[model samples]
Target: MRIGFIGAGRMGAPMVRRLVGAGHEVRALGRSGDARRRVTELGADPVSFTAAVGTEAAAVVVCVFTDDQVRAVCLDTPLLASMPGGSVLIVHTTGSPRTAEDLATQAATRDIRVVDAPVSGGPPDIDAGTLTLFVGGTEDAVTRARPVLECYGGPVLPVGPVGSGQRVKLVNNALFAAQLGLITEAVRLATRLGIDEATLLSALQHASGASRAAATVAAKGSVTAFNASVGEFIRKDVAAVRALAAELGATMGTLDSAISAQFPDTERKS
Candidate 1:
């Protein structure tokens, strides 16, 4: 399979390496010198975005950040026009569900298949070929993209058509944000109770209150430290989920309150 990839950053770099290691013919588009160097080192041929999309490939994998970036690269740049008919475009960016649906409609006229295949886990998981993929697309599109995805993915689930992957991912991130708020609040309570933060976190790890978010807070030594490190990214995800919920006429209820209480800065940004 000839795979054209974009956004060879921390997460994308490892995924490109996985595809190359799996013996795919990988060509990557990187706007930065460092990104180009990284993908080149991983055995991917460095090419411009225009060149990458223009070339015939079985799949084009996009792994950029934000809905705006995704739209800019795929729609604004009009990469879909250049992609060959019957080829698959796999978007790994966590973004609005509507983006995928809109792109699918646009791609259909060109006879290109669109797959919303947002991923979970990080660079290490990609390197280990154990990242989970929440996929949404036509059955044929998912089937066409599965082999390339399986090169770096664990369970590649086709949840529904078109935007379903983003819908599920938004819900997943919202729950995570809620859990982060709970974990931060728990840590604050432990502090006021005169209990050691570490001791409390360790106890929680062995108790029913444990969660990945709790462990992340524990590893960072405190809620403040954890928030300082990942608050912006988490906040971005929370905002996306909130916006999507509003668009769908769904209520976030306590999850919305929890996010506002825990990450007030994000609420202000919104």
Candidate 2:
């Protein structure tokens, strides 16, 4: 399939490589000089971010930093006109599902297909095609999205109709943020009680309390301590989760207060 990608950054560049390696023709653009070099350097059909990726593409992939970034490029772009009816436009960024629904409503006028298809796992998994992807759209749209999704991940499940993917992905991130706090505090308390960091991690890795993040923080403790600046990232994710919770009339009070109290402003790594 011929693919056009908007936004070339950490996640976007690697994804373009994955698609190119999977034998798809990728027309890519970057919003900055550094990003442009990285994409073209990796053998993609590269252009400036403003270059129109007008829709000869079988699929157009949108990956940007924020929800607004996703809208500015995909929803606001005139490329939707260049797209022939029935071509797929998949959103890979995570935000409110409302945007997906709104875009789908707007795109339908042109017969353009839109799907909320946020990815999970990490950058390493994206490179290895092992990320767990959640897709939500019409059953037909999910079916059409499968091939493109497989280029970067495994088990792209159709969870529900449009925006469901965003909901699920948001919850998934919220859970991780919640867990990070629990695990960190558990370890901190253990230390206060005189348990060693390495020992605590090793035991937790095999215990019922073990978590996906436990192994990561354990393996990289020294680095996580010095470089991970985890507190700041926790703030960003906590913010995303909190916004979603508010939209759903759920409370993010505990999560917010804990992070505000525990994580200092200077130490944020994401």
Candidate 3:
């Protein structure tokens, strides 16, 4: 595949390497000299602008940081128009479902297909080709995009149409945040019961309470350290999920309570 890539940053950089290693010809968008150098180092040809990424590309992957950035890159640029009629546009940012829907509508006019594929896991996961992708798009669109995605994805689930990937990612993040909240409470309980945090976490890892979150906390050796490392990203996802739920007149119920309790700063008061 001839691929166009945007946002070849921390997470996106690893993906570019994987795609290039998979024998795909990748052109990554690099707005600055430093950025271009980084892309070149990743073994992907560096392009100067967004439209250049789409030119003659089989699929253009947008792995930018946020929803607004994704909008600025895809909707606010000529990238889609520059793409070949049958090329695929794969969005890897986690954001509003409506964003993907809007992109899909816009891309349809140009005969480009859009896939919302918000990812879970980090650079290490991408390096291992085990990153989880919650994908949403038409079957044909997904089929076209799969080879590109499989270069660095594991458990590449097809959730539903256009926006479903974002919907599923939001829910997944919310639940994960709530679990962190529960872990916080468990730590507090252990403190009161005279059990050390490390001991409790270690015991829980072998019990039914074990989870990826628990294992992560164990590795960090404390809830505070673990939260400190991932708090900002989780906070961003929690906010997105909250906004999405409000737009749909849905509620997180207990999940909301737990997340708020854990990350009090994220709680939006009525």
Candidate 4:
């Protein structure tokens, strides 16, 4: 497989490395010299332009940070236009479902398929080949993308159609944020009862309230420390979910309140 990749950053660099190691020819887009060097270090051929990245590639994988970057690269640029017809566009960015739907509509004219394949887990998961991918696309499109996705993903689940992957990812993030909020309350309650944060978190792992979030905070020894590491990303995902809920005329209800407690001011500014 000839693959085009963008955003060779923290999460993406490992994916590129895995794809290259899987014997796929990967062209990674790197706009700067340092970026090019990083891509080279990952064993992927470096291309300076978006158009160059997608040219002649069977699949173009996008792993940019935010929704705006996804739009700028996939919509505002000629990368999609330059991609070969029948190629698959796999987006691992966690953002609004509408973005994926819109991209699919746009790509349809050129015969390119778009898959909203937002990922869960982290760079370590990719390295271990256990990254969970919530994929949304047509049967044919998902089939075309499976081999490439499996290079790094463990459970590459096809949840539904074009935008469903983003929808699932947003909900997953919202729920995870809520769980963190609950953990925060638990820690506070433990403090009031003279049970230290560390002991409470550790004990919870054996209790019914145990969760991946709880385990993470327990490992870090405090919710504050855990938040320090992933607060930016959690806030970003929470905000995206809030915006999506608003756009759909839906309500997050208790989930929103819990997330708000954990990530205050995460609401998208209009």
Q: What is the C-alpha lDDT of each candidate?
A: 0.86, 0.75, 0.94, 0.92
The C-alpha local distance difference test score for the whole of candidate 3 amounts to 0.94
Tell me the alpha-carbon RMSD of every candidate.
1.7, 3.5, 1.2, 1.3
Task: Give lDDT tens digits, candidate 4, residues 19-95.
Answer: 99999999999899999999999999999999999999999999999999999999999999999999999999999
Q: Identify the leading candidate in terms of lDDT.
A: 3
TM-score of each: 0.95, 0.88, 0.97, 0.97
Q: Can you write out model 2's per-residue Cα lDDT over 133-220, one digit (the tens) per residue?
A: 8898998787777888898879788899999998888777666665665666777788899997788888988989888867766767
RMSD, candidate 3, Å: 1.2
Winner on lDDT between 1 and 4 is 4
- Clash count of each predicted structure: 0, 2, 0, 0
In the predicted model 1, the residue pairs found to clash are none
Please give, for residues 1-270, the per-residue lDDT of candidate 1 as tens digits: 899998888778899999999999999997778767877899999886655654788889999888999998888885777788999999999999999999999989989899998887778789889999999999999999999899999988899999999998888888888888777677778889999888998889899998888887888887888888877778888888888887778888888777776777664322
Clashing pairs in 3: none
TM-score between model 3 and native: 0.97
Minimum summed lDDT over a 10-residue window in model 2 is located at 261-270
Please say which candidate is ahead in TM-score: 1 or 3: 3
